[model samples]
Target: MKASHDLSGLVKFLSRDDWAFHFEEVMGDHFWPVMDHFDLDHEEINDALGDHWAMTLWGCAFEDFLTQVFDPGGQTFVEAYLKRRSWKESAQSKAYMTALGTSVMSLYEASEIVPGKSFLARDLIRGGEPVLISEGTATKTLRQWERVAARIVPLGGKLIIAGGLLPFSQEASDALLEGFKALPGKRRRSRTQPLLDDEMLRAAAPLFTHAFLFDVLPKALGETRPIIHNSDGDEIVFHEVRFPLATGITRKDIAWRLQGIPQLRQENAQFWNWLDERSQKGPLKARVPNALAAGTTMEDGTPVLGNLELKGRFLTLMVNSAARAARGREMLENVLGKMVGVPLTTIQTIEQMQEARKGRTKEVDDIPLEVATPLVHAMLDKQYREILDQPVGMLGDISPRSAVGTQKGREKVAEWLKYLEFRSASSQNPHDPMTTYDFGWMWRELNIENLRR
Candidate 1:
């Protein structure tokens, strides 16, 4: 049998009537957060999370139980088990049991994963140099920079992860770290001494399980679909309203009429943008203000309420919400009264647009490599130039420049930068322009280059 199967057998052995109390105590602590958060009892939680996750949680508790000392003399379940059943197990199993008796569970950041082989794990909670771990099953699925709360044990001269591993999302990891820092006696520590001692980490093991559940339960229970709204607090729905121009009207006439309105900015002969002038002045003073007065802007601070483009005889107006589309249509009708014909409107939900975008391939012309490369880079540079000063939803709707002014905000910005860099590097196409783009400048701009690792 595999070593993990033997570990499972040990867990089962400890769950008998003689050791039921300790089993209940550890499992109770592990599952209490899920129960308390969802207001569900033991059976209901199992029904909600299903058998797979429930057993996974149980395994986490079992691993935590291995490190606990039930008696004043420091005897643990593994020690007690070996005392009685040592003769039945092989030498390797005995050694494994002994290792488990002393193993401390802590969170680790996984990297350089090689499927079906191994990966490098750096302890995030205990703070140590990264060590190569020979793991097969987990390496199949573990992503680079993913955090996992698990135990590493030396078995057969190789460090391997224990059976109980709880992978943590960035949100979960942040919650766990915050919870750890809020614990008594940890608040006064400095940066270099951020690592927790083995004893403290082991004692705080239940918090790791709690944080993971807090991150996962909402998603698993179907509560994570965000209700997105525009700055006007209107639920976002894409509205494409097309107004056909009158026979005698020309592009120049349309542009001249549009220019009379202060909100419209002419981009080209065929295009004009309906803009919110207030957004160009500076960052918003407050959220959820006048939607018409304070419209949405791109990352580079181009305040666009909607887009208008001329095609054949049709003048298409694309806006986010129905309210904006209606407003846009009325404004256009008033400006170019007899110059425009009847309008044709098409509406799509945000979810539908997203679904339609998936697997849709764009057709690119075969431009010369030398020309394409510089053009792509220039576009990217322009797009990201004012990104630091603009509000980002990922950084809690605050500008990165503003976010870096505080310690907690700085941490969030660092993680956001790392995520952006990771996604840019993960492009499937090697020749993709994004694959070669450097985020080093962005890190330097934010003054968090030192935390790039």
Candidate 2:
């Protein structure tokens, strides 16, 4: 479906402002209580970048060109933002329901979810009686045990209620069996079930536990797609992936190196080559899009003779976990090349931030500068940090407790994975998305020369 909103004028209008302020304003108005969940306040948002307009200058041109030139058919911010909201709300509700059931089930028999109170161990049902289920399967079984135990207790008999993960915990199970055997009764009829098959209990047997239900089972049922905001005024669907964010070169490191070597800029190509060689020897984990460049080839079956620059506006990066966030700085250390312009131009001062928060005394903390690193590493770290902390529909900003109760909860448990994919509605390098063309005709000569040669 096509979007009805006009993004061209909007894009032009936004481009004129300091990109950082625009982003901060957009996030502040739209992210809401969701942003609060991550402990990020308005002042912090304003302080995130040293150069508010850096991302705008570096990332915008490609996006603008993509909408205005390459692909005339475009979408808008309003539609995209609304779609993301819907996805987030739906996912949150689903997660909450599932987690509630699982949590209650875990404590079943020994204790129950008492509408508003905590579980009571003394009210367990143990004998044969008609069962009534008010809410859950465990509650029904508990009712049956209660009735049976009452009838048998008078005749010096016993009863046992079952259901819930309590029966599986070594401590709870042992305590239950001991209690059952020691119950006061002339003819005690303890609740019992057939033991697990010998084969099922073998050391090597693949065991399935309820934690698996809360942790791994949901993905098998298809709840991994998350709603993520994109630059082209839209939200994109993404399959979650986890990765470590710790460790990386960093933007400041690059800046320091570049600044230290005054002659580095005199030979940009040579400097890049030397850096690339060191990176090959450096102890760093290569990531997606960045890694994609190492093997990219041209349409005519020829590998292009150029370095891959993971730049531009319309890039959707899936930062699935904290590891990616922590290491993001190092990844961008002098290697990432450049970022979109809007984010870069939005840099703000402590004074501006204080002015913005004039009414709210609590938000007057001075804006802290982002850790400076090389352009590439800083950008990588920034993207990783943003995704690490940004409130995506499924995993980024939802309450940990809320997530555990639904599909989103299950996805959160898989935060150790590190798979990322890049999708773009607009790009300068259609053939090589990792890079962008700052000067439209700049690469044409290189291609023509390669052909002639």
Which candidate has the highest TM-score of all? 1
Per-candidate RMSD, Å: 7.4, 29.7
Cα-based lDDT for every prediction: 0.76, 0.27
What tens digits encode model 1's per-residue C-alpha lDDT throughout 1-453?
455338655766766545778878888888876788789777876676789877877777887888888864568888888877777777788887788778887888886678899998888776757788999899987765678988899988899987778888655776788788878766345656655777787888888778887767766777457456665567678999998889988877887888899888676888878876554332222243212123455433445789999888788999988998989999999989999999999999978999989977765777866678778878778767678888776577789999999888887887777666555555676567776676678888889765554
User: Each model's TM-score?
Assistant: 0.63, 0.14
Please provide, for model 2 over 342-405, each residue's C-alpha lDDT reduced to its tens digit, 9 standing for 90 to 100: 1111223334555777877544564322322244344544544444333333243443233444
lDDT agreement of model 2 with the native: 0.27
- What value of lDDT does candidate 1 attain over all alpha carbons? 0.76
